[model samples]
Target chain A: MLTILLQHTVFGIVTGSILLLATIGFSMIYTTKRFLCISHGELLTIGAYTTYIFHVFLGWNLLYSGVIGVVITSLVGLAIARGLYEPMERHGPLVLLFTSVGVTFCLHGILEFIAGPSIRSFRTPILPSIRVGGIPLITMNEIVIISIAMGSIVFLHVVLTRTRIGKAFRAMASNVDLAMARGIDTARISMFVWIYASAMAAVAGILLALVTSVNPDLGWTQILIILAAAILGGLGSIYGVMIGAILLGVVMDVGVIFFPSGYRAAIAFALMIIVLLVKPKGIFGGE
Target chain B: MFRRTRIVRRVLVVGLSLALLAGLSVGVARAEEVRFGVLTSLSGPLGTEGKPCFETIQWTVEEINKFGGPLGMPIKLFVADTATDVERGITGARKLITMDRVINIIGPSSSIVVAIMKFCADNEVPIISHWSGSTRLTTSGGEYQFRTCPDDYFEGEVAARFMWDEGFRKAAVITLDTEDTISISDALKKRFAAMGGEVVVDEMVVGGQTTYRTAARKVLAKRPDVLFPAIDLDTLKIVYRELYEMGITFTVVLASNAVQQATMDIVGADILEGVYGEKPANALGSPGYAIFEQKYREHMEDGMVGWFTPNMYDAVNLMALAVEVAGEATGKGISENIRKVANSPGIKVYSYAEGLAHLLRGHEINYEGASGSCDFDEFGNVLGYARIQQAKGGQWVDIKFYSSEDLAEAIR
Candidate 1:
């Protein structure tokens, strides 16, 4: 019984790490823009498909393909911000939110048109499992996913807290008008946020596609959970989002002990609602 | 000036009458061609299944037209994409019914058929489904709906009998939360329990989830003698992978839905070796089926056909035969004569041309379609048979055949 409990907990951590990667970018964008970016999920799809094209179709190495995919996804993210979001920014949050939904559909349609909706598997050889004491069996793919996710989170923490640009970003996130008045180029900062968050989303997408099969709906299907994690983590606090994601992930997996597996999503949403009802500003949101 | 004006007015009147006559004649000529609506999910998640079915329908239409069509007129197809969603399916059905004015419809899924059942019944349009296996679809009293595939109830019963025959007592079932999977799983559990077998674990998982370790763990905790996974290919892959990773070994008796070549290719044969399942059988040694396989390969870019591809071909041919026998291209005529043209008490015909020729000669003909001998019961569901298969040497090999009566008796 104890081993089983430990196994679920480990699995929950892995799930939490992936959700954290997804939520980091999501929350960052929301921090500055103050609007939900529904199209952020498509960045993950773009990343996975782009890497697939490079590795499978063009015969590039996995590492190179992933790097190129992330770079391209970041560029695409910036382009979207400049082309669509920038012009519609002054029209209120609802307009931006609706536009994001439209963009999400457009990206989903384009990916489907290109990939034809068939499940695509990576050509990477399946690694043998490595069993640890008192835990579920883990694979090399899971290890890599966990390491990269943790590494990216730590790096993001450093960048956000220790650098000059990070300080500028924090100021903008806190008060855009004041930050712009203090000569902090809010436009460039916003563009940076889009690129950085998109890059992280791409990494998350690649990791997810490696663990599961890649399809057009790979990102869309998980977007709701990503939203729940972001909302539960208080939307703007990166550290809070990470904690929220981990908590949600553990709950989702551990809840299966009592409820059926189909209720994982419901359990997570229910937790989000309970938090909203009691706390209102999330666990880490400022009053 | 009065004479000139009178001459102009006469010319205009004459041209107007000539145009009206020409329009009426064109309308009559257009009505001579029979239009059949083909609705399937040509895009989205079910696109892989939908595309082949759509292509098969097209191929059947082409072949029928080559043989001078039914009733001495060419057949035309108005195809639409459903995207595997009910709302999109409704839109496609409406377009096909109102805009294209098709005489009959062929769909690739039971869910879509059920969704459009009321509309088809109201409009008196007959819809022949190629691969929908839901029991409720036919049992809903939609007179215009007919299924070429066996219902899930039959599939579930067959699965239970197969398990019992294999000497498996305790069974655990993991099914997707979809209506079809749920029904099949429920049927299996009920029948298996009724037959004095134990059901240790019965769990439902939502589709499109990336992880199934939690579900797999819960299922494994039961430690049943056998596992029955009645889920889609993608979810099945995840669940099976998780089970394998957990160092769990048990016999897996899959539902017919997951027993496909595409599924095997995606899930890897190594994981599926020796797994048992059942599928709707094709007329294996029939000359008509051989021709279909050849033509399907020639037209399909992937050169791979699913089990239901032949059913789509059979559906199109059956509709055409019914139309010919009814002697009209209307939904009421097609629905009224579909069972007559497909059932027994007539000369057995294999191909569309053979059946059409027999029907034209004023003789009753029964169509043994490429998919098999299709005979629909009163509920618009076919009394079908399935073949038990196992994955051996990285390929599916048929081991036994179970007729509907055989399965029913086993359950009893």
Candidate 2:
């Protein structure tokens, strides 16, 4: 019984790591842009497919292909911000949100057209998993996922606290008009945020594809849970989103012990609803 | 008064010409063709199977027209995309019956078929589904409904009996919580219990989730002698990978729903070796299958075919044969003659042309087509054989064939 509990918790953390990576980007984009970016999840799909094209089809090294995929996804996010969002900036938040929904469908359609709406996987050689202290059995892939996610979180914390550009980002995130008045270029900062967040989403996508299988609707399927994480964590705070993702992930995995496995997503949503009922502005939201 | 009389004469001439043209066109349309509705999912997740099924139907119709069609009239196929959605399927069925005036319908998924069963029954249009395997579909008293594939109820019984024969006493099931999966798993569980076997764990996984680690842990804890997975390809891949990573080993008896070339490819041959599965036998040894393979390769992209390809081929040929046997181009006539042309006490014919020739000679014909002997019981369900297959050396190898009687004995 204890071993089962340990196994479930370890697996939950692995799932939580992916959720953390995804929610960070989702929360970052929503906070800076001030509209729900429904197409943000498409960045993950783009990253995954792009990596598959390079590594599997074009015969590139897996790590190099992943890097290139992340770069391409980041560029796509920057393009969306400049080409679509910037042009429609004056149309108010609801219109911008609806436009993102349209962009989501458009990106989804393009993927379906290219990938033929079937599941695909990276053609990697299989490796045996390692047992840690002969207790909880985990795979090398799981270790890699957790390591990268943690590394990114730490790197993001240092950058946001220590760097000049990071300070400017924080300023804009807090008060865009004030930051602009203080001579920080709001447009440049927003573009950088889009690129960075999308890059994070790309990493999440690649890791997820490695863990499971890749399909055109991979990101679309998980967008709801990512949204739940972001909203549960006050929608904009990086650290808050991290905590929220871990909580939701653990709850989802552990909840299956008490309930049937199908209730995983329901438990997450129920937790979110309870949080909202108790604290309407979210657990960490100010005012 | 003179100008008014001239205008009235011009109007009268134009009106008479318009009415005469409409009547002539209607008369020509009625004489030239018989239309049939081909309803199938052409765009969604099922499209992979649905497209090829539709193409087989289309190709068969073309072949029929080349041989002077079923009843000396050119057959016109009116296809409507169901999109694999229930509401769209209902709408498509309605439009086919009401607008296109089709005599019969062919090929939609089980859920869509069930959703539109009453609609077809009300219109008295015969719907022959080639892919749907739900038992409730044929048993629901929709006399107009028929299916070419064996139902899941039989598959479930076979699975339970196979497990018992293999000496697996404690069984665990992990299935997707959909109607089809649930029904099949329920049948298996009930039958397994009836055979005095214990089901240790039954886990229902939701669709579209990234991880099944929790579910995997639960199943592992049960430590059953065998695992039966009735999940989709994607989820199955994840669950198996997780199980392997956790160093858990058990015999996996996959449900027929998970037995596909795509599933094998995605899950990797190394992981899936020795896994047991079952599918409706395609009767690959039959001469009709050889002909189908040769002709199907010429038109299909990638030169690839699925297990259900033969079923689709048989569906089209059966409908055409019934049309020929009925000697008329109406739904009721085809309905009356379908069983007569499919069952025994008749000359055996394989293809549409052979059946047509036999019918033209005033002889009864039984079709043993690419899928197998096309036989339907009283409930519009086929008593088909199931092929027990195992993953061996990166390919599925057929081990044994179990007929309906054999399955019945096992269940008994």
A160-181, model 2: which lDDT tens digit per residue? 9999888998998899889999
Instruction: Please report, as a residue range, the 10-residue window in candidate 2 chain B with the lowest summed lDDT.
Output: B134-143
Per-model RMSD to reference: 3.8, 3.5
Docking class of 1: acceptable
True contacts kept of each: 0.42, 0.52
Top model by lDDT, which number?
A: 1
- Candidate 1 Cα errors over 4 Å, as ranges: A125-129, A134-137, B1-30, B287-291, B294-305, B404-412
TM-scores for all candidates: the values are 0.92, 0.91
Off by over 4 Å in 2: A125-129, B1-34, B41-51, B73-103, B287-294, B297-305, B325-333, B408-412
Q: Against the unseen true structure, what C-alpha lDDT does each candidate score?
A: 0.83, 0.82
- lDDT by residue (B129-211, candidate 1, tens digit) is 88888867747643688878777777888888888888999999898876667777888888899888998887888877667
- Quote the lDDT for B346 in model 2: 94
Give me the TM-scores for chain A across all models, comma-separated.
0.96, 0.95
